[model samples]
Target: MSKVTPSNIEIIEIPKIEDPRGNLAVIEKEVLPYQVKRVYYLYDVPSSAYRGGHAHKEQLECLIAVSGSFEVVVDDGASKQKITLNKPNKGLLIPTGIWRELENFSSGAVCLVLASEVFDEDDYIRDYKQFLDFKNQ
Candidate 1:
């Protein structure tokens, strides 16, 4: 297991271009540490609904709120931090070995995710107890 913690998580600022029509944001080039291998989004989530109750073993994820807002609680088996993502030009970068839970989504919220790897069930540590054991190893 890696020694990554919630403190390692970062709030990345994407380049935003101002225009008379509307503002534009970009997430490419040197903005990310790893090349994006998969892209996904979460939408139509109820306010009381929750998602992401697991931790990745190898994948790195960057989550951005493209529409509304949401909160992400990241835990490292020791410490935790709650982050609110409401800006399209900002993303939360989560490294491996940290547990994450997403909740408190506003209406019509769109969460755009950029991942470093494709979906793999083997890479996911779903059980909180199992994740704690993995962290101690």
Candidate 2:
């Protein structure tokens, strides 16, 4: 088994450029405080449920609720942290080796994730005990 160290979560505010029609925020690859290699969006989620029951060995990610609100639960083998994301311009950064679970998603909520790497099964740490063992090594 492997021990796990949760990544530091930072709240980044996306600069909104105001316009007559509405507002816009452009997220660039490296300009987003961290380099981004993959982008994904989640929607149509039910209530009292959860997602992301695993940890990434090397993948760093930022999550933002573009439409509504949601809760991100992160565990670091020894401790746990919970973050609420609601604003479209605010995002939570999850570093590697942290087990994360996403829950309490509002009906019309849209979650956008910016990842540091592409899809790789080898990067995922699914077992909590294994995560703890890995971190202790």
Candidate 3:
């Protein structure tokens, strides 16, 4: 497998439609690189709590803050980067093989996740040392 890095993650601008009531953002067809097989969300998370302490082996995901805000810390084996998601019209695309940790969630924050694959326990790498070894091999 090819090496994955924090730089591999990209902030995607979702198309917006303005209206008299409220603005609308859409994600369909070409907005994402892969077909979405699953959808999930996190809400009402405590600010002091942490989530997403694993990396996917083959699945890719796009995360969006549809409500409040949060921080995503992405790491390759060599380096790491922190990304803030505060806009509903923006989404962070995380490719396979990068370890990710989600933290610093604002009160009432809602994080929506679009996945390219269905949930499978075997696809997750939950240990950091094992993630590094997987990267090396």
**Judged by lDDT, which candidate is best?**
1
Q: What is the C-alpha lDDT of each candidate?
A: 0.92, 0.82, 0.92
Candidate 3: give the clashing pairs.
none
TM-score of each: 0.95, 0.88, 0.95
Runs in model 1 deviating more than 4 A are: 1-5
Task: Return the candidate ranking by lDDT, descending.
Answer: 1, 3, 2
Predicted candidate 1, C-alpha RMSD: 3.4
The sequence of per-residue lDDT tens digits that candidate 3 reaches over residues 1-137 is 12234657888888999999999999998999999999999998899999999999999999999999999999988899888899999999998999999999999899999999999999999999999999999
Kindly give the stretch of ten consecutive residues in candidate 3 with the minimal lDDT sum: 1-10
Task: Please report how far candidate 2 places residue 40 from its true position, in Å.
Answer: 1.0
lDDT at position 14, candidate 1: 88
**Would you list the rank order by TM-score, best first?**
1, 3, 2
- Candidate 3, superposed: residue stretches over 4 Å from native: 1-5
- Clash count per candidate: 0, 12, 0
lDDT of 3: 0.92
Clashing pairs in 1: none
